[model samples]
Target: MSLTWAPALERPDLLAEPVRHALEAMASDGADVAAVEVTEIDPDHADTAVLVEATGWDLRDMANCIVISGARAGEERVCAALVLGHTRADVNKAVRKRLDVRKCSFMPMDEAVGRSGMEYGGITPVGVPSGWPVLVDARVVQREHIVIGSGLRRSKLRLPGALAARLPGAEVVEDLALEPPT
Candidate 1:
């Protein structure tokens, strides 16, 4: 399927408020705004698997941002972990270790969507709450271009993998994802 790409800044309607603000902030920080683009998509195809089948895009070029939460000593910690569409976040190990919490689990869908201000199935690391750590799997950062959510199910964002690593509060974490069994 051919997709029409437009500069995300010029198509603010395609982005959630926080996502637009985050991209603008990155531009002000001297990041190349031209590197970010948005494309319209069927909301029904927002999930990674459906999107891959609908768009014929390589799954490896897609990134999935998963929200995870944990608590320790009465302190709650939340993080967004970016992994390749084909892999799973190691929430029980790598993520837990990084959050310094005894255990971590995927945040409930309602809470994740409500807290991030992004639609469920359309959450991206770009606009998660400023305090939440945006942990990126090392493999994701190596891709030249990665497709991620635009914070709206009707659209998607494409940007350099390096740019994803530069989002506010983003931290590159090695082995943050586990390969699925064959």
Candidate 2:
């Protein structure tokens, strides 16, 4: 089925507060963002499927999907989003390099939930903490629109690709991926 924007698809009962907040924030900024619900799949599993479907030039392309989790810095917690599938956030190398952290890792589940104020699977790139850095893959902008997480595993959000790059504290960058370990 084709994708379409519809608020009714948001599944409010399952919508994560951070995602809700992000959507509201984007709306306040004059962006037209909407959410759609679909079957849930583990990010790893989904990655494989996404790759199989992305033939031709699309394989190298980036899609805007939010993967929210708490990043650990000693006892501190930070929420983050990275573009989907083919690209890795370079969390260990590039992201840490960019953030100037000696070491970095995905936020622990509990910390991610606490900081984001949203359930683990429900986090979206939209309503994350104001100061949290948003890293967008430069390749994602090539698409006119993108489908990102809606703060919930069962749903996805659709919005202008450019708006994602404009999110507060977001920094658009190129070469966000690292070659998978051989």
Per lDDT, the best of the predicted structures is 1
- Candidate 1 lDDT, tens digit per residue, 2-114? 88999999999999999999989989989897899999999999999999998899999999999999999999999999999999999989999999999889999999999
- What tens digits encode model 2's per-residue C-alpha lDDT throughout 125-159? 66677767777777666666665555655555555
What is the TM-score of each predicted model, taking all chains together? 0.98, 0.68
The alpha-carbon lDDT assigned to residue 118 of candidate 1 equals 95
Q: Model 1 compared with the native: what TM-score? A: 0.98
Best by TM-score: 1
**RMSD, model 1, all Cα superposed?**
0.8
Query: Each model's C-alpha lDDT?
Result: 0.94, 0.56
What shift in Å separates residue 93 of candidate 1 from its native position after superposition?
0.3
Give the worst 10-residue stretch by lDDT in candidate 1. Answer: 25-34
